[model samples]
Target: MVNVFITGASGFVGSHLTPILLAAGHKITAIARSESAAQKLEDQGITTIRATLEDIDVLAKAAGEADAVIHLGFIHDSRSYAESVEADLAVITAFGTALKGSNKTLITTSAIPVAGVPTPTELSPGKIPPRAASEQLTLSFSSPEHSIRSHVVRLPPTVHGDTDRGFLAHYIGQSRKAGFAGYIGEGENHWPATHVKDAVQVYKLVLENASGSLKGGEVLHASQEAGITLKTIASAVAKRLGIPTKSITKEEAGQTYTFLALFLGIDCVASSELTRRWLGWESVEKGVIEDLEGSGWYFEETSVTKF
Candidate 1:
């Protein structure tokens, strides 16, 4: 079994991923910034390193000690998004330095929206998105000369499951605040989605197959439903919150949705067929619309004001 070092181990996807890895007999060492977070992971028999993403030296040391590294830790602050991206880049660079010429696996998390194309495949080039720099850098470290088996898992817009306080939850919260759930101009823009359960399996498979056919600098999409329209998703949220659905203009969306305005109208349709063929990975969970309409957890009270 591999000794894996993970960032964001207590996060939504990471929380689900950790237990599965442990069950599969892999040892996990997680970085926890808070004592409570550390204690919680420690209680689950995970070794905890008390550090944040900004602790590059600590992160490098931790990366040097592990057989593999899964980077899921990202600061979701829209107000300081550039800073968050910088921190992510720094952490990735540190990991690459520690694992250089080691041929160990390094899986970094990115989003499907990073691809500006109509239908993004694994080979689709990243555009000028917020996290594009980190994605490019991660893939660049996969050269045989570097010997770092780096892979980037581009997660869809909606990684839905219970206890999720992501973009979907933010939409739900916005719906609750406003009388009606709003979408931009006919709301035909689409978003790719996947369940948390299905998304975590991609990470596991990537780690497990690192020494096999899986090569460095490869990009994988964990998207299940390729394209769920914004109108459909908005309507689902409105129905769940017992609110009406409204069509708002782009200007109004900016004013109402604030930082989430751009994402609300973005059309990011991504395909994971290559990833499925490469790793034999199959998505076995409900899609975003299904999960939103069927699950009661999405409308629950939670603080999701930030991105």
Candidate 2:
């Protein structure tokens, strides 16, 4: 079994990934910033490292010795996005140095929103993702000859399924609280989607198939469907919450959602043919349809919710 050292093992993706890797008979050493999270990793039969992004020494040591390192610990404080991004860069740079000569695998998470194409394909490499600058930096490690097989998996906006209480839940909850399910203008801007289980498979496959071209590194999109229209999503939420789905004017969308309004307004349809062709990945998990039905958040937290 290959020994894999992973960061953010306590995160949504990491939580699912650790068990999957363990089931695949891989030995794991998970990084956790808290005792509770560390204990959780230990309970899963994986070794634990009581360290965080700031602990450069510990992280360097861990990356140097492990067979591979899958980084997932990203600071998500919206209030401190820039600071968190800079810190992430520091951590990645440290790991890149740690695994410089070992030719080990370093798989990190990125998103497909960097480019504005309504539908992005593997053929579109220079697609500049305004939201995902970190991806560009990580994949830059690729060169004519680099020992490290660094790769990026651009996850969907909604990495949904039964366990998702993230964006979709928040939006639906907000909608119910507002008394109407709302989507930005005409609600035609599309968001790509992938099941959490399906996304996890890409992680395993990249680690399993670490080799030459991967050494130059690659960008993989964990997108199941190219696009799911905002109108459809609004309908789903409306139906689930028993509210009227309505389209807000562009002006209102901006006033209500602020920074998120632009993203929610973008029409993106991303293709993951490369990810599938390369890894033979098949997202066999429940799609957004079941995800909306299962969360039951629409019914549970209705009274206090605000759109």
**Could you estimate the TM-score for every candidate?**
0.96, 0.90
- lDDT per residue (tens digit) for residues 57-82 in model 2: 89989988999889988876544557
Superposed Cα deviation of residue 171, candidate 2 (Å): 1.1
* Model 1 C-alpha lDDT versus the unseen true structure: 0.90
**Runs with alpha carbons beyond 4 Å of true place in candidate 2:** 126-132, 210-215, 297-299, 302-307
lDDT of candidate 2 vs native? 0.76
lDDT of each: 0.90, 0.76
Instruction: Residues 38-126, candidate 1: write the lDDT tens digits.
Output: 99999999999999888999999999999999999998754488888988999999999999999999999999888788899999878
**What pairs collide in candidate 1?**
none
Judge candidate 1 at residue 94 and give its lDDT. Answer: 95
